[model samples]
Target: MTETLVRIDGVTKRFLENGTPAVEALTAQIKSGQVTGLVGPDGAGKTTLLRLIAGLLLIDDGTLRVCGFDPKTHAAPLHRVVAYMPQRFGLYEDMSVIENLELYADLRSVIGTERDEAFARLLSFTGLESFTGRLAGALSGGMKQKLGLACALIKRPRLLLLDEPSVGVDPLSRRELWRLVYELVDQDIGVVWSTAYLDEAERCASVLLLSEGKALYQGPPQALTRSLEGRTFQVRNISGERRAVLARALERPAVIDGVIQGRSVRLVVGKGGVAPAPGDIGAGPEAVIAAVPPRFEDAFMDLLGGGPRGRSPFADAYASREHPIDSVVEAQDLTRRFGTFTAADGIHFRVKRGEIFGLIGPNGAGKSTIFKMLCGLLRPTSGTARVVGLDLAKAPSEARARLGYMAQKFSLYGDLSVRQNLEFFAGVYGLGGRRRRDALKRMVETFALGPHLDVDASTLPLGFKQRLALACAVMHDPDVLFLDEPTSGVDPRTRREFWSHINAMVANGVTVMVTTHFLDEAEYCDRTALVYRGRIIATGAPDDLKERARGAGRSDPTLEDAFIALVEADDRESLA
Candidate 1:
């Protein structure tokens, strides 16, 4: 049986962004008892749609309905049955996790027996019992989102609306959050989830694909993907190999889109278009462009790249370095503690120069703790860390100066313009004259920031900001680069391009130590350390780690499979 929970009839919203249409009139429908993914780019009016449904934004035209009530006309009554968690969930930072939940329950009119029952169940379900006394500000990104969802669950609303609940969250936490969402729906609750990832969209029952605030399609994510499913040519190439020629061949007007996967290329050729024959793609190179099935990512690229959407670009310089990491960073018995909590317990790892090392873990696996200590942002509770062959604790400043860091949020000065931000960082890092000018010019050209050079960094899109942060990190040519979840919230195409830059740096002999919540990225790392409960639980090549994943209860596991199995095993052990 098909269920329809929320419906939008000719829903339209428009706003003047510097005197332009921020959104166009759009119509969408969300089914009840099913997860509906609202997928699109950064400013494709994702947030606006959520606002219209939440009654926070009044549509310029058309009608919107939720649970049979008009959102604009009967917001109070409609809100009673709906829960909306906006992009940045506002919580009292000073309040304890339990205190925050109690407040939300009171505000939502959840009281006494029902509230207490929900609280207890939520604590156990989310495994948050230990942090009830911890401040909201102290909770990790995943914990905070879980708390946010718990607060929303206080009212037991029939409809749930989430805007990128898993955004910026670690992969394990993301999977857990989705599990909780499924649990809610099993209880007959309706969920309307919005995200930019096609992978996440695969889990949805239906999807409302929006572009420039207009609905392009509305149906099951799978069906929508299957609609245009047809011939795709899979071309294989080495990661750092000369795959650009194959891409260039498909770049003609006849081709729709081309993508890189591990060591293969998925090229979509337009029907009746002028494209190189599969056999004639490259005369000498062993590139095979064989027909294959259409992936969700392929479908997404088709919709996105089929039109005249703006492109994001950045430089991927492959300049070689004279010196290698004769041991870029080495740690022995690294430990970190927060009060009585052990974040990283006796962790040990080594980062070599020119190596692309990926650090991954479950949400509470203590990856961040190790990253902070390695970057010298936090002091270790015990043991030592040697960065660039020097002790981190003894000469922190010099060690820091030798490393470039792109924080989780990119943390570039928001108010400053692209050029201004670049110049500021360059000056701070003691860059001067021709060198600074050349670097700035190259970055502007590479990231396609030429037009928006004067625009505030905050005004840029998520993907652009990701590129800018990376550019800034590489501006001074630091010997070591530390990126903490640098690709979070970025689209898939942009993520690929960003990896291109990282690969260039590795080739240039600048050691890269990265921590990412993305499991697929684990494939790019020469070696990976799976940190869990403040210890190195697994360390090896991605394939080897995948084998360990099978030991954790996953057969024929991918990186994501390994990640989830490891975390779930740890959790079960904890409960036992």
Candidate 2:
């Protein structure tokens, strides 16, 4: 028999957290030629596990053998054959896409004979053919993600560890990503993919469910799902947004798992949460309801127990005060182009105070092009974009000064403390002395960083780092906020909390312009514009768009269905 690709014999990894354990002792194994997924919510010890396998973290106990090499002691030798891509894989923003690929190839020490061929193959697989000349900063969320993957693939490692590889990608790009992974597995590479999306995990050969530094379940996704067959029921609530009531019902101990589906929640029966008898749960079982097949989501909810049904802390704590947004932002036939390609075609929109505006689209739909243009990072090819009545093209500095922009993957100096990072940005915003110190203190405290203020940014967890980024972005008290997929890869609870902060900022009359991939997130925006092929094809409130989606021939659609339908329609229209 072929040798096992990875063997972890009771490996335990832990970090000192106020003298408490962060991750407990855990044991797991991954076989060869199979894609094993690490599935969990935020802070579930997914990243920590990957780091441990990559030899980046010391194992407090037990042993790990990757192809017979001990990652802890043989780091240099193991590094020669395995590839680990962290959540924020470094991609040089100022360099062209091709340049970045070549750089990675050189770093891996690929021979000249196969270097060109390797680069071409990686770029082609990533769908970055025509984007070779585009600066890394100019690529969309999906494109940048693909670029990161391509660079990792350039090394042709036998073992691949990818962290949340498809979080912000669109459906088309997601399919392509899967294709690439399949090809890698076909090449006999063992892949360990970490993700929050359980549906994605179903595609893997086996799954290891992690919870708070422990393995909750490990087996074939199919078998684990079959073990709980006939336990789940598709349920719906009569009233919309009254979902709070439905969620409460599903939370009983008897309900093994429940997931939100458009207007209703699919529930799996468990110990304490008994299925509400006929008429007991709105329309009881056998009330002409669909008995849906169990999905990875059902299995996930079963494993973790039903999670919180509301927004994250950032969303819940929104302090809405009346700050009339005076001339928030205006765009008139704003245009951006790349050679013969028009990235933004005659775009026009006005954002007002207390408004939560969103840009929704497919992977290469040019949403990022417009976002960059709005932030003054990329000049418009034609027309004008105004911020607080200041024209970005003519008065770039004046326009940029009125707004705060957070990139999709926000960065911080790894060596700096949370307070230091806050102080640096505060200074950039021109506040200093007593005000800077006070603001720094307030930001550090508000984001719950007071305890970790002295900890280096590099030592912080993903959620903490995200909060630090938010603190830095708004420390200057800007009038408008532009966030590009700010919640991607974040925990569902944290995502909810992040939205609360956004809502709070809007309540204070701060204009919010955001982009996101979580369909449920679309519901939070006051208004969303569906962008496709460089144009706004549909614009309205979430409910309004749902109605339009039904009119477009999809019945009883969720925000995801509405999104795909609108994006498809936009594509067809553009083709026509």
Candidate 3:
């Protein structure tokens, strides 16, 4: 029989006097030897619920018990049996990996032989045995996450709480993280994983879906996904541009959600809403409409009132400007070296006018290095990068003036209000007077950010932060836009909203070069380049790469399958 690790009844927590509760009347049970996913959108109280379980926060009302102890009255004992890893794990960057592990062991009082055994086991399990001497500051994004997990497990607690552990991790690393957590579950450790990725939630033993601090559903992910069956479909053989078709489909009252998948548009029709025909969605006479398997994302969007609809106001406001050159972004033998290490080795790619080119790879695979060199943030070691026919090395400022960049992390001033950040970026991009005011007004209206104009950028939710970042990035309306993981930790609906604007911009002849870990998002790109260990291993359309990985037992493969297969094959060749 499985042990019930946590029990909650009518729990409520609020941070403000009159504001909505962060968590309201939540009731659930978490069992040992199982993974319970706390899934929700930004500010959905997922984090608050996790914190309550770990005894980090007190519930205002309701009965709560963890490991048979009242958290509010017995937090100390609860802490001994529980381990909480926050979104930002407190790893000391200046310390070596081994030193950091030892520090955590000391904090947990696991000294001598026990500490030594735990360190050895963790290092081996996380694949960090070879890099134990490296500094934490120099570790890759995925490696840092593993190290944090190792530290969290130093005490070997019975319950584990993870807050978005795989936020910016690559697919391969994310799979490994899941493996590590399940290994602990096999030992009767209860795990609660909070995440924005619906696919991940689908793998959990059970999921607690939250919205506006209230529980919308609590059960197996399949239960929710099953409800969306017969309503999900694939619209194929599009006569017009796929993006245009998707935009048109989203406008229909019957369509709850729609997105570009390969060459077709995947849609979810509202319950009791009429199913759309090919002609209804602007498809050609020969276009085919087929009912497809429902996914967890479809159900999530359905419960959340669907994603943003209608054409992007930002795209509508963008006036098309012609560039004399055909290729807007060109990188020829781009190379960048740091001391004894080469970060980018002879990389070459080109983005034609009005194209969306994607650069994707594992963590620390030099995608960001190539992006920085092209954007003039870093100088190339031996080759040339140009934007709008201007050499970045010789005419960096001139080249940059025609570019818009959004970093992997939010780069706006946290202390500044939403309005202030917009004003600052506008000035930096040379907008003034009526033009600046008009741009701000348009951005506020486009992203629906009018309500939070005076709020600090740092205080905004994850989705709003992403919107603000994008609004500032495109306020200048540059000819070329560079986005580095623009939708890294946002929810599916937020991603749809972001891509809607991006697709609109591309249709209007604006060129875009983006790097992302979300392979699904790569489907929107005209072409993609796969970088690995400072080199381009493959470059082609998403379907092309998927075809390359298809063989033997697998006739059809997902983008993630192709990514893993390609990387594994390369690893084997390197070993040989």
Q: Pick the candidate with the highest lDDT.
A: 3
Candidate that beats the other on TM-score, 1 or 2, i.e. the better one: 1
If scored against the real structure, what TM-score would every candidate get?
A: 0.87, 0.74, 0.98
| Tens-digit lDDT string for candidate 2 (1-576) | 234778877777656644433456677788768899988877788888888888888787787888789986788878877888787747899999989988988888886878988877887888799899999987876788889988888878879999988887876677668888899988888999998666688899999888888888888999878755677776643343323434454446565444444445556776444565424545444343345667676667666665444333433333444444455777789889899999889999888776778888887777878888888999998988887778888899877877888887657788998778887888778997887877676676667788898899988877788889888888777878888878877765466456556655664567888887776666667678888888888888776788777865666666777887777776687689
- Cα-based lDDT at residue 402, candidate 1: 85
Better model by TM-score: candidate 2 vs candidate 3: 3
Decoy 3 TM-score against native: 0.98
Q: Candidate 2's C-alpha lDDT? A: 0.75
Give all candidates' CA lDDT scores. 0.76, 0.75, 0.91
Clashing pairs in 3: none
Q: Residue 276, candidate 1: how far off, in angstroms?
A: 8.6
| lDDT value, residue 406 of candidate 3 | 94
Which order, best to worst by TM-score?
3, 1, 2
Mind giving the per-residue lDDT tens digits that candidate 3 earns over 1-576?
Answer: 589999999999999878889999989999999999998888899989999999989999999999999997898899889998888758999999999999989888898899889988999989999998999989988899999999999988889999999988998999999999989989999999999888899989999999989999999999999999899999887777888888888889999899887777899999898668888777889789899999998999999998887788856788877889898999999999999999999998888998999998999999999999999999999999999999999998889999999999989999999999999999899999899889899899999999999999999998999999999999888899999999987888889989999998998889999999888888898899999999999999888889989995668787888888899999999999
Model 1 spans > 4 angstroms off = 1-3, 112-114, 227-293, 306-318, 324-326, 382-384, 451-460, 550-556, 568-576
